[model samples]
Target: MTTISDGVTVVDHPLVRHKLTLMREKDRSTKSFRQLLNEIGMLLCYEVTRDLPMEMTEIETPLTKSMQPIIAGKKMVFAPILRAGVGFLDGMLELVPAARVAHIGLYRDPNTLQAVEYYFKAPSDIAERMVVVMDPMLATANSAVAAIDRLKERGAKDLRFVCLLAAPEGIERFRGAHPDVRIWTAAIDEKLNEHGYIVPGLGDAGDRMFGTR
Candidate 1:
């Protein structure tokens, strides 16, 4: 992992770079895009959970008993911002099937480029669990910040944000809003365009993933 800043990590694994490149192709089919995303999500998940706390427990083998390490403490919560964020959920869940899910629904206002939330659901004990917020793109960061705001209001304290791509402006905005939270992403792109879309980014992640465009 490449550290872009104090709390930002870029998952620069070869497989992650290769799959992200494939997904960036404009001609790539929705099926291929979704598949690549899922694969990359799994890779990113592995990197993100690398430093999770572990505890030793005794397990019985055929020949003898052995002490094995397992994730300790409360199961983490995977909080995904709606639609595009959902694309990362399946692959992440495949790795951490025991993790809980919290869904935050928000959309960007086209003209103002602000996040507007319509739904939010989470476990009652969210504050006690680590919350990893997943969103495929972090361009303006309005959605990410808004989602985290709602999460904090609901008592979630330990939080992390994950994305497929991010813009410098978005990173600054996100870090400025929530300095305590760490960020994990496949790559940090150039910048956001006039309409708040990441330059050189695989355009409209939600549209691309769902074939809605």
Candidate 2:
């Protein structure tokens, strides 16, 4: 794994690499496309949570010996940055079933061409626990940055941004805005196109997943 910044981790797991190859294919159908993204997200979640606090717990076993281990915490929050981010939720929760979730709805202002937050919600323990923000595409970094800004305003401090893919431009912008926030992704593309999409990206993640276009 490569560190984009202090906390941002670029996961290079074999599963992520292999699934990403299929995701990049033009022939991959929407059903397969969505499945691959979730599977990849599940794999990526493993690394992002490596530092999570785990406490030893004791439990009775069916055999003569008695021992068991369970996680300890109020619960981590997975806050998806609307639309596409919601796709990674099930995959992430499959690993951390007890975790809470919050949704932040944002859309670009057509006239100003900037991100605007329309809705947001999080657990009361946000500041005390880790927060993982999800968005499959980090193209220009505008929306990702805006999403974090809103999360912070809502009392989230220990924050991490997780995405299926990112472009260099978006990575730079995200880091510049929130140096303390780490990023996790399956792959980081080279550049953004004139229209703000990552060149050679898996097209629009939301469109591909939902077959909207």
Top lDDT hit: 1
Query: Cα deviation of 117 in candidate 1 (Å)?
Result: 0.3
Residues 1-213, candidate 2: write the lDDT tens digits: 877656567798887899998999988999999898889888888888888776776666776665555566767899998778888989999999988998988775646557788888888878887899999988877888988888788788889889988888888888899999888988888888777878788887887889989
**TM-score, one value per model:** 0.99, 0.92
Cα error, candidate 1, residue 1 (Å) = 1.1
The residue ranges of model 2 lying beyond 4 angstroms of the native Cα positions read 64-69, 109-113
Tell me the spans in candidate 1 whose CA falls farther than 4 Å from its real position: none
CA-lDDT, candidates in order: 0.94, 0.85
What clash pairs does model 2 have? Answer: 7-182, 8-182, 8-183
Q: What is the alpha-carbon lDDT of model 2 when measured against the actual structure?
A: 0.85
